[model samples]
Target: MKSKSIGLSPKSFYYGYDSKKDLKHLVRLVLILVFIALLTGMIGIWVVYRSAHERHLDMLRAFANTQGDVLDAYMLLDEVKSGRVHGDTPHEHNLDNVKELLLKQESFLETGQLLLAYEDTSTGKYILIGTGHMPSGQHSVLVVENTRELTPSMRLALEGKEGVLEGQDLHGAPVVTAYLPISKHNAGLVVMLNQSEFYAPYHRARLITLGIGVVFVVFGTWVIWSAEQKNLRQVREREQLIRLSFENSAIGKALVAPDGSWLRANKSLVNILGYTEDELLRMDFQSITYPEDLEADLDHVQAMLKGEINVYHMDKRYFHKSGDIIWSHLSVSLVRDEQGEPKFFISQIQDITERKRVEFENQRLHERLMDQLSLRRQQLDTASGALEGFAYSVSHDLRAPLRAMSGFSQALQEEYGDKLDDTASDYIRRIHRASTNMAELIDSILRLSRTSFGELNVVSLDITAMSKRVVENCRVVEPDYPVEVRVAPGLKGQGDLRLIGSVLDNLIGNAWKYTHGVENPLIEVGQEHVTLSEQSDDSVLAFYVRDNGVGFDMAYSNKLFRPFQRIHSDREFEGSGVGLASAQTIINRHGGQIWAQGQTGKGATFYFTLNHTQFDSEKNSTS
Candidate 1:
């Protein structure tokens, strides 16, 4: 038997369909939806109305209680003024005040009023003592009806049953009112709000809900009918979209037969291979694939046929129609028939020639940079060794000569004193001092160099204790100097213990040395709060050593940390000038900073910061 394509023609597909039955079903569904929508809207409207009404009643209850309290207050005041409790006749002035207060409150509401009434025992009727709508200066009058004819709210209040309810007011207008009895004053208070004003919002909500329900019904019904008619067209459009996507794709796409022959190719594939679709269909993938990549491609194909894999992806090279090799990222998937027989392959290819070229160039550049870095590291090692040798020479070889010179000068001065004049003795003393200074200078240079070169041994340090120890050492060296030193407690930091101690020695010792001659000398060691940046909440702790001493000039403060630089004369204060410089280097090695602030004879402060420690400013009470 010959095989036949089982497909429906457009004319038969359209003409043989029963749309009327489907339309009837859709109409029924839309009607059910509209009914549900309307029912929901009605329930929503009712909910809003009840909620608004209850809220109004709550407000009315509050107002009635407040008015009752005010009336009781006035009655109590009147009783006190009359020299009795619950006087039979209340003060008339107090009544007038109550009426004025009620009138003022009435102005705040729209269609709202307050009524104060007391029952006449003999007539069994209520007498209005005050009303918000009354004339300003009018006296009490019989404005309300008898107890039987009074409004429900007022009757309830007279009976001492306090509550809020909807009823008619004295003017026969519908209203919501709160009623409370002031038993002490033998009167009742009624606060009324017009029903129309209170319910306006609820009515607007109902109307809006109804309008929305109607619009929803009409729009929903139209949408259901239109969607039903467009279903067939959408299916057709989806097929067209798939076709257009395959043709307009930037990457190459092809369908190949199980025999490795091209069954179909898209325009992008034709462009990539520099061939027409008809020309590609006559060839096989193996003919265009580079020889180096052909074996791998064939392996993947064979494995796919044997059910080892459903898809394979790889970067491979292919020979274009122009005989140029191109790098491509290729993805292939097998499509099988329902009976598990191999049908064809779907291949997607992306050209990656430029990407491969850039990757190759970067690989070469990386290798070159690595070589240069190795050479530079070797050179730096050689220089560092040379520097170490030079420091050894300065510390040992040069220092020995200075010591000899100083010893010879002292011996000459002591042994030849009788033969020498005053000028010669002065010359010998100067030579001894110079030799001592030079030796000290050399030591300071070595200390400064070591600060920058050593590996940091960071550990938790009690900076407060260190500062105190430095201060105690100063007192031991100069026992007569009576200076007050205060080190703040809880000053903790993280840094190399020996290096940080050295920094403290320089800073605190300098403070002690400079405060020698000043009366009532004082030194303070504390941490200051320093924020890293305005935009960041992170902060660093900076410890400061402050002193009351002969401070240096602010203009020359920049020279304080330079090697051998001095802002003061040697006769006034002695220093090698490398202490602050060494302190700065140690701080920098630990990722911190150091600076000084001073004036011309008032005081000076040296501040230094350390990494990885945050201080609480509240604990800092030193200065």
Candidate 2:
């Protein structure tokens, strides 16, 4: 015998239920889980790659140190035989012997090279002689030209720095390189390993890991979808027994008459309304419905009676027996008899009071956060206005007094030179110098303020040409030394021409000033295209001004870009101590960074990048 249901049809039951909403929520959960899995896999791959890269770097460093020691032995042997050894310019026969020995050692590596180089002081360039593996079991010696741009490893090595780095080789192939500066010989040794070959296994592993993660996600999603489909089918089957199961259902269920009186109420409904089933049946639904929601519920009931809608579901509030409001997901549907006459209504209710409470609390927190954000913006605006006012005062009110002081002191020194004692004349001269220095300090401060606060006027700039002009200006300032300057060709960037020019002037000018007493003073302005990382092909161009002159202590390198902070005293080097600070500000405004590297008595290299927002991109330290 087929069991007859009470009032609701299968179509209305399905329409009134939230099955589709539940399925959508489950789908979102699956997607979130998949995303988390993929993210975790990517993080694992990155961790493994970082570990492998670090290991290889350490190995390369150890190998380079060994080779450096070997070269030291060879130089000692040569010194013993020839009574003299010049590493910067080794004897041809001895260099050949050393190359042969190094080449023999390189047989252990599949894609490795041994490089020997010395700085050609005449041209401020490196003269590279390398031995690489050849197919015929013989070594090839290639002398790279002086015109080729020096790699970071080469530059650091020539400046007596020893480290391992990843960069391009002479032939422009990406390579992991190890460099050692032979202090006694004043030369450098470098070893090259193909970067792609070294990291090929790790790259392959990462791809395999991602493939596995994707497969797992797809399979897991399919399993979850299959389970959900099965559950949906079971739910549809259970709809046939709804009338028999109504009293035992977990959700609040009720049968209401056309006149809005509760014909029957389940235990869940009684519990939700905090009322007895008999009490609920005696009262009409409108009596217990919250006043604010009663009108909408009536409108929905009217629409259902008029055959305009079969079912309706909404979030509504109900007045409980205790006079407290109850939030619920309410679904109501019209029931019809066989004669096309209206019957009772079937209502399903689920408690959502906690969810509503959380939603309202989140809204309040969001409003508070927005208010705090507005307050911060207002404070920032006020601070900026004050800074502007301070800048204006310094520019206008401070300069006149400083100028008068300098002018009067100079006048006293010049007009009263014969009448004044020697001590008085010296005192006047000191006063004049102090006032002039203070004026210069003020100018530097104003420049920094402008650089920090001014708007950008970005344009394509010919950096090579700009560098050449700056270097020429440096030459014009001190023509007696005849320092060799090399500016790389065809360099380009986007920046304010005036501001970038100032950066170059400060850097190159500093180089020129510090290299005054150095023999064979060399200043090379060049660019290096540095890869962001092994996993990405993106690269940034870094411009550097290299000088063979006096350098500062690395311990105080942090003070280099602080206003009025000088690593070297005025007696050793003269500077306003704000040039680098202003340069930093301008670079930061252009979305870039500036840094320096140097060792005392060796030289300094000032490196800066433009239009690069991420400043922590890896770069090798200069010696």
Candidate 3:
């Protein structure tokens, strides 16, 4: 029997083998494509997430810096007004008002909180002196009484480091905090916002990116498995989307080749340079860079390529297509391949021409202001010198004639007492008295002039000792008057010794002279610790001279320090009315203040402070 169907077609056998091999190859291709898609999606997600996080952090930092600047301005204003003549006790009251105003002004920021805090040197704990927003359920407006344990941010601020911190707030909510020191006051201002609120936009972006990435991965897998030609088309579409995203960005963006040529540039970049995209792509970055800035940019690029730095940012000038100079803030980062080799550079740029212009205008205005101030100062100096010369002339020329008139009148009275009639003798006596009074007035004017122009020599002074010397001198002058003086021991001050001594003599002598006939006459000199608006600590010394003397009406208190203005007649109080005026001039020259408080026949008190304790040499120099 013939073998049953032993013969086979060669074409059929070959077709079966070819089908198996093609199926195997297709399976391998699909697996490889899926793996690549998954990896690419994960990397894209990570990159997007990291970028979003960094951007959020940058925004928070900027906000914090702005808040710090505002707080610093308030502090500076407070310092300027600290030693002003407000006529209030314990200058801290004025500071409280300023703090309240700051809080009211800043409370409009609903999303964040602003606070002024100080660390108690004795307790080493932080105290919140002012707050824009009270914590939940807290009703007290003054938070200074409530001290809290120090936070890391507070510690850093007190240590003079301005920075940002992420941690829980007093209410135990996660927050981002920025703090800076109040340099003049030994305090800190903290700005804080809820972390969740700050990151809300990033969260939304992350979710959107995740969904889009998932869709693209699924669609990509299907396209790859269905047809190779379709896969290529899908890839082209993805690249187009990426390009669209790059071009539509709000900030200028560009891709630069390793050779410094711009491989691709977005519309924003083209607009910034006033050039077309095609034109920019053909030009290298060095060609458009300002000559002064090109060298630094090259150095930065070289550093990035050498892996010495990952990114660099600078403010640079670039030449526009029209050859005009344009200022821009540039940020660049190097992109690397999988093998960690430099591939290209990604650059982001922002136009800062308007900011630069504003800064230049401000500088010009400042220079003009300084020049005007200098000219005004010169004018004042000229006027002051002329006045001083006139005063000197009056003191010298007028005093001699007055003295001669008085001496001749006295001689006439002594020699011709028997020959002259009673009326003539009375007239001579009047002439003598008038000339003496005029002499006293001229002397008072001279003292006033000196106080205004005298140079000061600042030094530590034992005020108690100085007061004792003044009291002793007053006793020698009025040995008949019965007076009891009390001076506090260890009373110290910082000021010009000679001027302060003169101040004490006038104040104490006035006190002694005013209490003419009262029983148990007393004068007390002492210092009290007071707070100033500019300083956090209560270290200022307010010296006062208290006396149970013949005090005047409060209504005329404003005229007490005016030259030649007296509340009492010469008959009641023998004075030229220049003592207080001279004292005021001296105190003002020292950057101090003087004020009087009294009532009719009850008593009088004079308070003054040597402001050198509160103000530095620079401020005192101007004053």
Root-mean-square deviation (CA) per prediction: 37.6, 57.5, 51.8
Residue runs of model 3 more than 4 Å from their true location after superposition = 1-245, 303-308, 338-341, 407-420, 529-541, 612-623
Candidate 1, residue 202: CA error in Å? 78
Candidate 1 segments whose C-alpha is farther than 4 A from its true place: 1-240, 254-265, 269-348, 355-377, 411-419, 531-540, 612-623
- The best candidate in terms of lDDT: 2
Each model's number of backbone clashes?
Answer: 0, 0, 0
How far in Å is the alpha carbon of 535 misplaced in model 1? Answer: 12
Compose the digit string of candidate 3's lDDT tens values, residues 1-623. 11112221212221223445555786788777767876887788779778876776666667656766665566456656765444434234434554666556544244466666665555555456434345632222333333445456766776777877888776677877777776545666667777787667767876887688678767876676578546445755665667678879878998776667776677888889998877886678889999999999999999998999999999999999999888999999987766886666889988888898898899999999999989888988888899899999999999999989999988888888889999999999899999999999999999899888857998999999999999999888888778899999998777898888989989998999888878889999997654455556534457899999998889999999999999999998899989999999989888888888899898898888877645454335544
The models' CA-based lDDT, in order, is 0.78, 0.79, 0.76
Candidate 1 structure quality by residue, lDDT tens digits, 363-432: 8788788888888877777776677677878999999988888998888888998899999999999999
Cα distance off (Å), candidate 1, residue 395: 2.0
> In terms of TM-score, which candidate is strongest?
3
Model 2, span 227-311: residue lDDT tens: 9888877776676466448877899998887767777777888989998877886778889888999889999999998999999
Model 2: lowest-lDDT 10 consecutive positions: 1-10
Candidate order (lDDT):
2, 1, 3
Stretches > 4 Å off in candidate 2: 1-352, 454-505, 519-545, 588-593, 608-623
Give the range of the ten consecutive residues with the poorest summed lDDT in model 1.
1-10
